[model samples]
Target: MAALGSAGPVLLLLAALSVLSVAVFVARLIALRGASAGAAARADWLDAVEGGAMPGAPVGGGAPADRLLARAAALLPRRPAPEALTAELEAMGATEVAALGRGVRTLEIIGLIAPLLGLLGTVLGMIQSFRALELAEGAANASILAGGIWQALLTTAAGLIVTIPALVGAAILQSRIDRATDEMERVIGRAALAAALPRS
Candidate 1:
C-alpha cells in the first residue's frame, strides 16, 4: 500500500486500466466461448446445411456460426438472387466478427500506453531528485537521492507489471477472434454453396 502510495497518480491510472483490461478479457472470453464452435461441431453444421437440413431454427442459444447458417437457411426459400444473398451473409458475418472483437482495441491501447506512462513517471522522479539536490547546494544526502530515485522508479515497475499481462491477454483474445473468424467464413461459404444447389 505504501509502495503504491508513492507510485504517483499515473501509476494509479495504469492500475485502473489494468482492471479494465481484465474485465474486458473475461467478458470477451465468455462471449467467444458461447459463440465459437469446435471443428467437429462446425463440420456437423456444414454437413447439415449441405443436406438441406438447417441445424436449428433461427432462434438464439447456438454457436454464432450455426446461428448464421440458420438465419441464412430461413431466407433461402424466398430464392433471393445469389449475389444478393451472398452480400447479406457477408454483412452478417462482418457484424459477428465485430461483436467478437469488441473491447479488443481498448486492451491493445492500454497495453501500448502503460509502458510509456511508466517511463514518464521515471523521468518525473529523476527530475524531482535532481531538483532536491540543487536546492541543497548539490550536497543532498545520498539516502535522500536514492530514496527519491527508487520512488520514481516504482511507477515504471508498476507500469511494466501491468503492461506484460495486458499484452498477453490481448494476444490470446486476438487468437480467439481469428479462430471465430475462420469458422464464420467456413459457415458462410457452406451456406452460399447450399444456396447454389439446384432444388429437387
Candidate 2:
C-alpha cells in the first residue's frame, strides 16, 4: 500500500493501465470461451446435418456452432469432391477462428509494455536517489534516499502485478484458440468423410 502511495504519478498511470488490460483480458476470455464451446458443439450439429435434418429445425435448440455447421453443410454441394469439400471447410473454420483471436494481441502487448514502463520509473527513481546523495556530499539524507528507493521498488512491483495477470490471460486465450481450432478441424474432417461416403 505504501509502495503504491509512494509511487505517485507512476502508480496512478500503472493503475489505469492495469484497468484497461484487465478489461481487454476479460473481453478476450469471453470471446474465446464462447468460440471454443461453439466449436465443441459442432459434432452433434454435423451428425444432424448429415442425417437430412430440417435446415432450420433446432438441433435441440442448437447453438452458434450448430448454426455454423448448417451454413457449411449448405455450402457443400450435393456431390462435392473431397478436395473441394476440404477447402471450403477449412476456409469456414479459419474465419471463425480469426474471430476468436480478436483483442488477444492487444492483451499480449499490454503484458509486455507495462513492465517496460515500470522499469523506466525504476530508472528515474534511482537517478533521483543518486542526485540526492550527491547533494548530501558524502552524507546522504536518509529520508530522501529512502523515498527514492521506495519509489524504485514500488514501481517495479506495480508493473509486475499488472503484467502477470495479462500474460496469464494471453496464455489462456491462446490455449482456447488452439482448442477451438482443433474442434473445428475435427468437425470439418467428419463432414468431409460423410460427404465422401458411398450412398447404397
Candidate 3:
C-alpha cells in the first residue's frame, strides 16, 4: 500500500515487533482459556465421581481427567489403604494441574520483555532522528523529527497494549488455578477419610 510504503524503516521494524507481540498475546489468551476450562471440567468430574455418579459418554473421545476419575473409582474400592488411594489421586491431580498451568511462563516472559523491546525501538528511532539532524546542513526539518518521535511513541503504546492484558490474564489464571487446587485438596481429603472408615 502507498501509506505503508511511506513509513520509514524504523516504523516498519516497530510494526513487525507489534505484530509479534500481538501473536504472543493471542497465544497466551488461548492457553489461559484452555487451562481455566479444563480445570473447571476436572473439578466437576471429581465431584461427580466422589458422589458415586458415573460420567456420561466421553465428549470429543475422552479427556485425561475423565480417564483418571474412572481409574480412581475402579482402583479405590479395591485398594485397602486410604493413604495409597490418596497418593494415587493426588499424583493424578498434580499432573493435570501442571498441564493447566503451562504457558504461564511464556506469558510472564512476554510481560517482562515487551516494555524493554519498546524501549529499544524508541532508542533506535531517536538515534536515527539525531543522525539525520547531525547530517543536515541547514535547519532540521520539524516534520521529519516529529515523525520519528511519533514512531517511538507508537511502539511504546503497542508494547503496553500487549503487556498489560497479558499480565492481568496471567494473574487471573493463577488465581483460578489456586482455587481449583483448594477444591482438589478438599475432595481428595474427603475421599481419603471416607475410605479410611471401616466397612459396615
**How does each model score on TM-score?**
0.86, 0.81, 0.68
Of 1 and 2, the candidate ahead on TM-score is 1
* Predicted candidate 1 versus true structure: per-residue lDDT over 1-200, tens digit per residue: 45433457777788898899899889888877856665576577568767877555444445767767767767777666667778888899898888788878888898899999898888877887777778888567997678669867888898888888888888988898898788778877776787777666
Question: Model 2's lDDT to the true fold?
Answer: 0.73
Q: lDDT (CA) for every model shown? A: 0.77, 0.73, 0.61
Clashing pairs in 2: none
lDDT of 2 by residue, 9-118 (tens): 77788899899988988887765555556553466666765775524433432333454466566755476776778788788777777777787788888899888878
Note each model's CA RMSD in angstroms: 2.7, 3.6, 5.1
Native-referenced Cα lDDT, model 1: 0.77
Q: Record all residue pairs in model 3 with backbone atoms less than 3 Å apart, i.e. clashing.
A: none
- Model 1 clashes, total count: 0
lDDT of 3 by residue, 1-200 (tens): 22222234534554564565556656645554433235455566556645665465323213444445455556655644889878988898898779767666666776787777777667766776677677774878886677667666766675676678667766766776665566556556655765666654
lDDT of 1 at 70: 69
Better of 1 and 2 by lDDT: 1
